[model samples]
Target: MHELSLMGDVLALVKRDAEARGFAEITRVRLLVGDLSNALPDALEMAFDMYKAEGTAMLASEAQLALELRQARATCVLCGLDYVPERSAAAAMCPVCRFPGGRITEGEEFKVLSYEGR
Candidate 1:
């Protein structure tokens, strides 16, 4: 769905980096996805495949894209306790004391891990 557009952005970023780095071919692209990021794993991969078929004229048609998800975690603002909250309250306040606002310690990540090119 929207992952298609997200993937396009990712590919475009890689293409720009490759050009700036002077790499003629990009062999691999790695992405760091968070569980709470709301980005689906399967859909992201499918988007990459679609982009490859379109031959963006930047990345090699055979360029590989890897998506890796990180576990979701949060830290309690009041107790300073760290735990994984349920999907329902990931962004809400701490379940225990409901004190300070829940801050995401992990997950909710979308980044390029690494890229291999020549």
Candidate 2:
């Protein structure tokens, strides 16, 4: 899965920053994963575990991964209605006015929120 490479990139970035700050090992990582981010949380976790199992030097033996799921949200301009959108839908649609052009307000995030190292 692409999550393997994605997690690799994240860990590399964290390792670089943490080492620059004089940290010896990464203890935790927190990610904000939106529903529409196209990155699977389970796959990410598996990738993290694989890295940990490999005994990566920058990762602590008990390193933890925390994924904060963000729900997809959209707002209809025609009806002024805000609602959650289906993750697999091609476009955001408003339930109230049945508008097919609802503007997405959130849930496209796929980033590292924070990392802990020491």
Candidate 3:
């Protein structure tokens, strides 16, 4: 699965960071995921659980992976207006002018917010 591959890459970076900083045990990892990033939160969690303690020698068995969804911003194609809709998922059309198929300005990022280690 794509989420599995993505989680592998994330854990690799975390392990590298932990090694460079000489952390004894990784406790938690927080990620910011965008709505347009095409990442399923549940699948990502399951994937992370599989590898959180694999490559990282110092990772705790109970290490937590947390993901938060970032709000999406859309710009109207016709009106050239940018706005954040009340509900992003149901906002395929522009809320203000009823424009169809707005281009996504944001909410396409998948970034590691922070990690806690001892």
Candidate 4:
């Protein structure tokens, strides 16, 4: 459902790039997906099949997904302590010096690392 829409968006972006760069045929697509990014690789592949139907790019294209694991970061505003968050804990707090809320600094990103075509 959502993956289909998401795949549509990705295909649109890729089509724009292909047209702008004069890529006649897309051979492969390489994507680096962050752990926090709400995308399932399997679902994306399935969605790609549905979205890219009857397209030039679809005839020779396939999406290659690379999952990126991100470490949770917690930055203490009170003491400026930067530390990795524990997976078991719901929220990460400063271990050395207790802080009310340690600001989360990373783990939210989705991007296309590379696309090979033409």
Candidate 5:
């Protein structure tokens, strides 16, 4: 999965920052993942485990990856309704007005929130 590459980039960035800060090992990483971000949480965790198994110098043996899941939300222009959107649907639909022109208000986030190292 693309999560491998994504995790690789994340680790590389974290390692660089940690080294610059004189941190010997990274203990934890926290990520904010949105439902519409297209990155699977399970795959990201597996990728993190794979990298940790490689015994990377900057990563602690017990390094942990924590994910904060953000739910996808949409607001209907026609009906003024706010609801969770269907991820697989091409367009967000409003249940009240049956409009397929709802605007997405949240979700679509994929970023590293924080990292702990010492």
Candidate 6:
């Protein structure tokens, strides 16, 4: 699965950071995943448990998952005005100018915003 590969990258990053900071063991890892980011937390946890066996850092680490919400930015085609929408997961049209299909501007990001370890 893609989550397995993603976990591998996460583990590598944690290890790299731990080694650089001289941390003997990682007790916890807090990750902020955006709502629009296509990632499965359960899969990540399972993969981390499977991959961190016998590892110095993650063997005792606890993976914490936090959700971050992002309002989708859309532009009204009729009025040429950009605004953030209220809801996600819908092809919401512009209410003010009645644009049939507003252009999306944001809500597509996947990255590790913050990590806590040691």
Name the candidate, 2 or 3, with the larger TM-score value: 2
The TM-score of candidate 4 is 0.67
> Which number leads on TM-score?
2
lDDT by residue (tens digit), candidate 3, 13-117? 887899899887788989999977889899998888777646443568888988989888889899988977555356558877898788888888999999989
What is candidate 6's local distance difference test score?
Answer: 0.65
Candidate 5: where is the Cα deviation over 4 Å? Answer: none
Residue 24, model 2: lDDT of 88
lDDT of 2 by residue, 1-118 (tens): 9999999999999988998999989999999999888899999999999998998748899999999999989999898899997655677878787888789888889999999988
Candidates in order have lDDT scores of 0.82, 0.90, 0.82, 0.65, 0.92, 0.65
Best by lDDT: 5
Mind giving the per-residue lDDT tens digits that candidate 6 earns over 1-118? 7888887786678768877887665655556554445766677677767776646445454545444555457788779888776564366478787666788777655556655565
Q: In model 6, where is the ten-residue run with the lowest total lDDT?
A: 56-65
- Taking the tens digit of each residue's C-alpha lDDT, what string does model 4 give over 1-118? 5877776776678778987898876666666554445666678777766554656344363534344555557788889999876656666678888665778787555566667677
In model 4, the clashing pairs are none
Taking every candidate in turn, the Cα RMSD to the unseen true structure, in Å, is 2.0, 1.2, 3.1, 3.3, 1.2, 3.9
Q: Name model 2 segments beyond 4 Å from true.
A: none
Off-target runs (Cα >4 Å) in candidate 6 are 52-106
Arranged by lDDT with the best first, the candidates are 5, 2, 1, 3, 4, 6
Counted clashes in each candidate structure: 0, 0, 0, 0, 0, 0
| RMSD from true fold, candidate 5 | 1.2
Clashing pairs in 5: none
Q: Write one digit per residue (lDDT tens) for candidate 5, span 1-118.
A: 9999999999999899999999999999999999988899999999999999997737899899999999999999998999998867899999788899799988989898999998
lDDT of 1 by residue, 30-79 (tens): 99999987799999988888877777736677788788889988888778
**Model 1 residue 52 lDDT score:** 78
Candidates in descending TM-score order: 2, 5, 1, 3, 4, 6
Instruction: Please state the error at residue 63 of candidate 6 in Å.
Output: 5.0
The residue ranges of model 3 lying beyond 4 angstroms of the native Cα positions read 53-58, 80-92
Error at 118, model 3, angstroms? 1.3
